[model samples]
Structures are given as structure tokens and as C-alpha cells.
Target: IPHELYEAADVEGAGPFRKWLHITIPLLKPTTLYLMVIYTIAGFQIFERVYIMTAGGPINATTTIVQLIYQTGFSDFNYGRASAEALILFAIIASFSFVQFRFLSTDVEY
Candidate 1:
């Protein structure tokens, strides 16, 4: 943040929260959106934590796509289905990445 903006807001009697809300948040919107998209993609790939913690036990409630792929490929010995599932996951992530690029490209401001 630039000191001039805070000085200007201070001159206008805006409180800390007000300045944060009206100034800082807007400035950080692009970074926040980028991070949100990145994290969303990463979240979709979650498996190690769930596997290490629960092993998708008790009816496989905690299973993720990666885990599901591993089970399908290795445990069940169905490489085709696992490959299809992986393709589906890839398509989903690709779609989200496409949307992110399209949105950020068009909506960004200087």
C-alpha cells in the first residue's frame, strides 16, 4: 500500500476498518482471486492428507479423485476406468483454469 492513500483516508476521517474495506481489499482483489483459483485447483487434487488421516474408511466417505483413481487402477486392476477417471479430473481442472484465464484477462484493470 502507498502511504499517500492512508494519509488521504486519514484526512477524510475514515477508520481503520473503513480504509481496509474501501482501499486495501479492492487493491488485493486480483491477487485474492488468483490465489482462490490456484487453491481451488489444488484442493481438487487433495488425497495424501485424507488418505493418511482416514484412508477413506467407514464407507469411503473421505475418498478423493486421486484416491479413487489409485483404488480403481491398483486395487481393482482396472486401468481403463482409472484412466477415464483421470481424464475427467483433468477436464474439470482444465475447465476451471480456462474460466480463470478468461475472467482475469477480461476483468482486470490497470
Candidate 2:
């Protein structure tokens, strides 16, 4: 943060909450958005953790798309279903990216 901003805030008698709410949070908007997008993409592609923990047992409750693809392709030896599931996963990721870009891709001014 620039010293001038805090100095001005201090001069204006703004409290810590006020400075954080009005200045700090606004300044960090871009970083927040970037992290949100990155995490969203990563969250959708999760597989190993769920696989190791649950392995989609008992009813396939904890299965992820990637895990389903693995089971379909290798375990069941059904390449066609795995390919279709992969395509579906791609479509889902693409749609999410499109929406995020459409709404959150606006240029933020400092």
C-alpha cells in the first residue's frame, strides 16, 4: 500500500475497519478474482484425493469426473464412455470459464 493513502486515511480519522473496507479490499479485488478463477478450475479437476480417500465406494458418492473417466476407461475398459465423460467435463470447464470471463474479466482501475 502507498503511504500517502494511509496517511490521508489517518488524517481523515478513518478507523482500521474503514481503511480495510474502503481501501485495502478494493485494492485487492484483482488478486481475489485471479485466485477465485484459479481455485474454481482446480476444484473441478480434483481426483486423486477423493480417489485415495473414498475410491467412489459403496455407491460412487465421492467420485469426481476425472475419477469416473479413469474407472470407465481403465477399470471397466470402456474407452467410449470415458471419452464421452471427458468431453462432458471439458464442456463443463469451458462453460464455467466463459461465465467467469464474461462477468469477472472487466478491467479494474487502481
Best by TM-score: 2
Candidate 2 regions exceeding 4 Å error are none
Per-model TM-score, in order, reads: 0.73, 0.77
Q: lDDT by residue for model 2 over 1-110, one digit each (tens)?
A: 57788789999999999999988877776777788778888998999889998899679888888998999999999999999999998899888877777776656565
Tens digits of lDDT, candidate 1, 6-108: 8999999999999999888777778877897899799999989999999997899888999999999999999999999999999999898888766664343
lDDT of 2 at 88: 93
Counting clashing residue pairs in each candidate, in order, gives 0, 0
Model 1 whole-model lDDT (C-alpha atoms): 0.87
How accurate locally is residue 18 in candidate 2, as Cα lDDT from 0 to 100?
Answer: 98
**Which one is best on lDDT?**
1
